[model samples]
Target: MTAPEWIELQLQLPREQCELAEELLLALEASSVTLEDGADQPLLEPAIGERPLWDLVIVKGLFAGDVATAPIEAALAAELPRAPLQQRWVPLDNRDWSQEWKRYFEPIQCGQRLWICPSWMAPPQPDAVNLILDPGLAFGTGSHPTTHLCLRWLEQLPLTGATVIDYGCGSGILGIAALLLGAERVIAVDNDPLALTATADNADNNQIAPERIATYLPEHLPADSGADIVLANILAEPLIQLADTLVALLKPRGQLCLSGLLDSQLEAVTRPYQRAVAFQPPAIEQGWVQIAGTLRG
Candidate 1:
């Protein structure tokens, strides 16, 4: 049996009007709607609970193959008369939409010894420690500058036999990478249940022994828990707020790697920890920075 094709309507508009446009598309019975950066701008380190949009957004709507574009155009004109909208349409062939995005995810090598590869692809460097990953509902696929920075940092560290804590574990990539790099044990923590689940699943996928990695909600972390290394790849605000708590999780002389902040935010994020830890220069990539520090006894 042949499946029905779909039509994708795409329009560019000011960022401020994206919500209105999305609502209108839903009202018009679009099966799905997505927004992308129309100008290919970089959006880095959005705060928790904040939905940062690009200056120009491309709003796309998927509709039934037989739907008429005139009605959609008329509806938009009626609802947003002053909106500067340039609309185009493309026909989408019926296929596995779930797997379609996989085409864009490729194996990425971080620093000297690590590779992040999707499950479907073979490791580009056969001798490197490849972290098998798939794009999921949670974040951290190693493609983002922040994750890339963290991965690079991890690759350079002597993780062998170290105890590590991965706060805000996201997809558990950092913790799992530490495990693969010979960390004796890792404690993966996240506030989101889905992220915890993703971390556990990814760890298992990499054949990490159950005893080597422990998944936890932030509240579930033990009071006496301390690690030789701590990794927190969350945003600046929370990073500042949790400064003491993150530092407390580290053993004396342990290293801390903090990412997911803009270059301009380095001072604000580092100020809280400066009294307790000696920081290295920030590692910057595309306006994002990763701060690494060593805890003082």
Candidate 2:
């Protein structure tokens, strides 16, 4: 399909006003927004410290006409801390994004031995242990810091003949990595149907028989079932809420790796896991954090 012409509007709002900005952005997301790039391109700004401002990107088509733009502008002007200091509209033309996007992805090495390479990317030397992954919308392309950190931890952790459960298994990268690392069996769970399908496809790509890895929604897993390793790379709130249930999925002395969090959010989620697991300083990359811990007596 040909790419759509896009107008990129960059908005800078005060830090306290970011909430309103985010809400507005979500409203736009809910609507059918058009961007020069595919929907895969995220609009959220990279995490900035407690800065007093936030940058938001809104595609033009979503708010093209005067009627759409006026309401958004008026809403921001009314609810925002103050008038946005900056608002610029940049025109974007659709290009062959597939090739352009691939340029940003390459072989990613985790730990000393583990390597994650895109299927189209040349494999690393045979001597180096490699995990081949095909990038898709579902997440865990190994480019994300959290996924990289988890892959590194997986390399260091003992996985031979172990049962591993990947909670919120986006793209099934982590669980598949465990399988390639010698885990006997892997169970990948995700709430999204697309993620489940992607995970299954990725497993097949990695030569994992359907039986070797089981994919299910969280609601489908048996209550009593537990795993030797539990990995969750989801947001802070859900992580905290699922702490008891997640921990219960771990066998005594099992280990867990938690990501999709900021360093500041570490306490809220790790605190609950403290009863069964000892927390470790988070692994950080690109300003994102992933915490790890081992289940204790």
Candidate 3:
């Protein structure tokens, strides 16, 4: 069967205006909207929870080929009068759009001992602890600094025989990595059903024993048990809000690793946990920071 083509309407505007453009495009019946750096800016490594973009961004909206471009252009002009909108209409060739982005996601090395490789690719370092993963509807492929921060911390920990709770376990990357690194058991928890599915699928792909890894929704987590380590790679706001709950999930003197925070947000995120845990200096990478600490005994 032949694939259906699409018409992509794009506008070059300041980064601040990209969101508005995306919303306008969606209202105009665009099937999807994406933003890219118009100035070809290098985003080597973005801060945890940061959606890094260039000062100038190109907002692209996709629509069925039959949709008229005139209305979209007219709406942009009317709604975003101040935006120096340089618009273009391009025909997006029919192809597997979902898998096309995979080309850009090569194997990523998180730490000295860990490597995250797409299922289709061969491991660059055969001896390393390779994590077979792919970008999916859920996050965490070891490409994001936040995930890398958590993976690096997991690699350094004495996970052998340890029990872990991967709170907010997007893609289940942290929990899976823990299991592969010799953690006896991991309880993966996430509110998103898609995330739970991805984590389970990835765990199966890795041939991890079903008994070694368990998946649960937030409310379904076993209340009677606590873990030797707790890892949460969610944004700073939620990290602060869930500080008590996360701490309660850990055993006394158990370790906690928190990522998905910008360097500037370090103090605010850490403040909520300080009364109960003693944090070590944060691990900073590309403007992102990971906070790891031990609960007070």
Candidate 4:
């Protein structure tokens, strides 16, 4: 059978004008809008209650195959700061999007002993420490370089009977991996309640006992709680901002692993904790940095 057609109107615009262009596209009845980095640039995460964009962004508006383009372009020209610096129309094949993601997200091995596998697929190596993950829009399927970096770190650690905290526990990926690799306890914490739910559900999916892993909103985690390891796979700014909070969760000489920052931001992110923690050299993958350290006894 032939696939239904679709139109992608792609425009390159400055960061300041990207939001306006997106609004204009939606106003023009585009089905969906996507924004991408136009120039190879350092990436930053959105701060709470704030939106950040690349210096140069490529915005693509998807429309029905038969939608008229001339009127949309006219509208953009009138409403935007200026005409898009570059523009083009690309043909698209409409497919069953529900199953489309499955094609690309197969089993991924982060280290010799660990694999992140979707629940529906067989593990690439059954005897390996396989994490059965079915992400529900929270985050962390091990595809992001930051997640991969963390997963590898978890795999190599001596986690038996360790108490671990997964701060910013998106989809509970890191925490669950810790449990599967033999950690005795994990405290999974996140600001988003949905993330906590995903974390709890994922832990259950892995056949973890309800008592083995605890999920919490940041405010609800006990102040006295301490762990042998704390993994914070959140962005750079949050890592810096939460330096004191993260440190307080560690036992004496406990390990602290952090990722989700670019290589350039490592020094700044580490400065807040450097005085008390002896950090190992950072692990780099795809330009993302992961730093692990031990709290001084």
Candidate 3 per-residue lDDT over residues 1-297, each given as its tens digit: 443577788889988888888899999988778888899888875544357888999998888877877877888889985755588888778764434556898998877888999998999999999989987878898987778888988898878999999998889999999998889999999989889999999999999988888889988888886999999999889999999899999898899999988889999999999999999999987788898999998
Question: How high is each candidate's TM-score?
Answer: 0.78, 0.70, 0.73, 0.73
Residue-wise C-alpha lDDT for candidate 2, range 1-297, written one tens digit per residue = 533444445565444555566666556542232223212344453532112222343332233322345556666677766675566554446543224457777898888878888887777766777778877778788887878878988999878999999998989999999998899998899888898999999989889978889988889987777899999988888889999889889898888899888877777878888888998877887767888888887
How much does candidate 2 score in TM-score?
A: 0.70
Clash count list over all predictions: 0, 1, 0, 0
On lDDT, the stronger of 1 and 4 is: 1
Provide the overall lDDT of each model, using Cα atoms, as 2-decimal numbers. Answer: 0.90, 0.75, 0.87, 0.89
Candidate 4 lDDT, tens digit per residue, 27-79?
Answer: 89877788888998877644322356889999998887777889888888889
TM-score of 1: 0.78
Top-scoring candidate (lDDT): 1
Residue-level error in angstroms, candidate 3, position 136: 0.9
Pairs of colliding residues, candidate 1 = none
- By TM-score, the candidates rank as 1, 3, 4, 2
Q: lDDT: which is higher, 1 or 2?
A: 1
Deviating ranges (above 4 Å) for candidate 3? 1-100
How does candidate 1 score on lDDT?
Answer: 0.90
Overall local distance difference test of candidate 3: 0.87
- Model 4 segments more than 4 A misplaced: 1-97
